[model samples]
Target: MRGSEWVPGVQAAASYEARWLPKDVMAGLVLTTLLVPQGMAYAELAGLPAITGLYTSILCLVAYAIFGPSKVLVLGPDSALGPMIAAVVVPIVLADGDPGKAVALASVLALLVGLFMTVAAVAKLGFVADLLSHPTQLGYINGLAVTIFIGQLPKLFGFSVEGEGLFADVKGFVTGLGDTVPAALAIGGGGLAVILVLQRFLPKVPGILVAVVGAIGAVTLLSLDDVDVVGPLPQGFPPFTIPIVTLGELGMLAAAAVGITLVSVTDTISTASTFAARAGQEVRGNQEMAGIGAANLAAGLFQGFPVSTSGSRTAVAAASGAKTQVTGLVGAVAITLMLVLVPGLLKDMPQPMLAAVVIAASIGLLDIPGMVRLWKQRRIEFALATAAFFGVAVLGVLPGIAVAVALSVLNVFRRAWWPYRTVLAKPAGVDGYHDVAQYPDGAHIGGLVIFRFDAPLIFANARTFREEIRRLAQAGPKWIVIAAEPITDVDTTAADMLEELDEELNAKGISLVFAELKHPVKEKIDRYELTRTIDPAHFYPSLDDAVAAYGQRERDSA
Candidate 1:
């Protein structure tokens, strides 16, 4: 393997330009501002201590810089993964109520995810990222946004509410409404407004950093003793450790890990593609998987949880003039210094402010415009998205992911089982033959019927194809010419059906023929011994050729 394929950072460092240092350093310093608050908030969201988020941020940023292909992409604790982590860890930890156990389980989960992704990268299985289709992904994210927003409501209001799922959380929040703290509410609500307003109007500004700093100041100055704070963090860096769990628990963790890997891989690939396009670089998908896996593995070894690419943080870095991975290296160093020198720096930071950070991220995940666009363009895809949305929002995160994958597969099958079948006719002044249903006024040849089936001919659709051909035969045309361009592949069952159908039609003084059949599919027909009943001479390279041959035969007879 090429050195750049495995360790892209070394290649980048070897070719490092001196002029990029200042910009990278400045961007790194600016990124630190947003990273601190977001890391802590996402850690809490994952049902781990706030400090673990910092550990995750430091480790992932450093590790990705070494192994990642993208120069400016940032990796850290993500808002979307919070509920997924909590879903897996909370139930297992609640019984013991040991924070240590919770951290260990989360670390192990991270290890499993890292292992899965790394192996997939080695096997070049990056296409598994397509397991979640676009429409379903949009719905799943929308549902997750609702789940995260609802889950944080109690914390945002400066209280604790416990429930199992979305509805339970909603009920818990409503029941605990009177327990709201005014000071926490002010800080959370105000911070949310400030971040949203700045993001909308002044996107280049570090709005999250501003909100976090402002909240810290308000809490310290106003002496808001009533508001809950994160308290002082543990000092220094996390020591390398192996997270262990029971064998029985391993099965459950593995299941959740697979789901998390899917989400993480999808998120990373999409984000990498976007930034790579902007920078005029190619997306090395397998390398990207390896990079993400390395980051997760490093974090898991250091008592940190799973991490994914942060589009918002990457955008912040880019907007701040990031030119290389050195930017992330700088951010990691800054975070490590803060952990080592002053763990108490954010002791006065209000918990509500953290809630606001998460809520704002959740709001960004909504994608209502995409939903509306899908509905306008394709109702079937819109339905798939809706199913996926309800799967995540109503059923739960893990189950919702399952629903999303199932829906994508089933949708593909639905199209194959009953594909669009149409007849073609030559319209006036048109270059090619068009669908008869669409061009009803077009003229059809007296003795020829042109049929089109818009899907691959496979076992699932073989019967459907045969039935459609029979129906078209009712027109009593002397020749039936199939526009076979859309039929990209013909499976064994479909080839067999074609042989039988051609024999049946030939018995009725009619001939069956294929026009514009792909070379690959034609090879399959010959290999399947379909030439015995269906004449090889009946196949034409083009529809016009087939029609002209029929006219020539008629003229010869006259």
Candidate 2:
């Protein structure tokens, strides 16, 4: 029972209600319908055999059921990860053109990613999931969506395009346009239309499942020999086996694993947070990381690849009234039964139909509305998002992730480097001093400057602070009183600058005072002995107190 804190599924089972059993069973069956086609589709998308997707789905679901904290979050192979996986494994396998080697490399990559995620969870590093900022993440995903849609174009039209990056893929698609098979195009186009229409109008119907069934039926009835079918799947459940790779390949796979783990953790945490809020459950972030790690590890061990939380699948399960992890377990069992008893069930399913499934999923991944909102609200953030998008479109998927992360980090530094600084003035009928830019008619006392610097006094912006103060000093004010409420920190470089600036000002018959400086920053000032050079009496607890003191000093002098 004590260990149940770590193993949440055990706790859930202990408190299981009888009424939930039927709901879980039904939801699991419904979930399986959507899972089968998607699993096969995403597997092909990842440059692996379609059957491996089922193995990944089964293993990840079962493992997540045991270790996952969220009751409704679903773990599986994802459309977003497909290209990333292919980017890593395809180049390596291109030399030998062995499907077996590709699978092994991908599995090893999954194992490494799982290990990294598990270690991070233990270290309580769940906050690292925010590696991708919202704007940059939006751009990267949009770029990825476009790349995937183009990559799948040749497949959707019944030909194969072999190229890297967006431009090359587009060119290959164009060059191979003459080889397009009409039957494949019609079936694939019709399948995509069916899914889009059903999903748009009839939300409850499993559109992917319907499209798959219809395509298979059409192929079988019409004897469509021009189309490419999935053929028979390997029989039985995935066997437990350790994926191995050479020492030379280990480093490259590990690098890919880091990117995969980052994306997986981000996706899982966000998905879990959304579903948990709807379910009225708290998000245990660290526990969720462990759950994701366990699922990936399990999949990697069983001839499968890395996976993440699937928002679409979870939505389906929740809509169907899933009550517990039992739903996921049920889905896993059903997939296992299908593999063992009906291995050739989807043998007649057309490859173009699979492309349609992936293309539809890719379309969903785009956030056009979100991109438009970013552009309208904040142009700088829109630029960041656009840069991230181009990073993926111009460079490869892996490099694009690098670009997004770099841009996010640089954006943070950019803010801190030149944060907003303004002059504050007390306006008529206002409670306190406000930005003078917003109150041009605000009153101002002679020989007093109420300046505000809206950032920490770090080394990055110390020069900027010095220049702003010097610029204000040229007006010949007797005192410059900083509205310090927003100045959260006073580093050593800033303290030194303050001492020098105060001395320089005093030499010019002007003084510097601080009001509403936070206690922590004051403590740092004292630690740096800044008060020895600058007067301690100049420090005031609030803006009002500083103004009163200034007025009193002037009256006494008069």
Q: Could you give candidate 2's per-residue lDDT for residues 1-558 as a string of tens digits?
A: 145677888888889999999999999999999889999999999999999999999999999998999999998999989999999899989976776898898899889988998899888899887879999999999999999999999999999977889999999999999999999999999999999999999999989889999999999999999999999999999999898888988998888888888888888888998988887889999899889999989999999998988989999999999999899999999999999999999899899999999999999999999999998999999999999999999988999988988999899889999999999898999989999899999999998999999999999999999999999999999889999999999888888899999999999988899999999989899899998888999999999999999899889999
Give stretches of model 2 more than 4 Å off: 1-3
Evaluated at residue 290, the lDDT of candidate 2 is 88
- TM-score, candidate 1, is 0.98
Q: What overall lDDT, based on C-alpha atoms, would model 1 receive against the true structure?
A: 0.93
* Candidate 1 local lDDT, 149-252, one digit each (tens): 99999999998987899999999999999999999999999999999999999987888989999999999999999999999998898889898899977899
Provide the TM-score for each candidate, comma-separated: 0.98, 0.98
Clashing pairs in 1: none
| Model 2 lowest lDDT segment of ten | 1-10
lDDT of 1 at 203: 88
Quote the positional error of residue 93 for candidate 2 in Å. Answer: 0.2
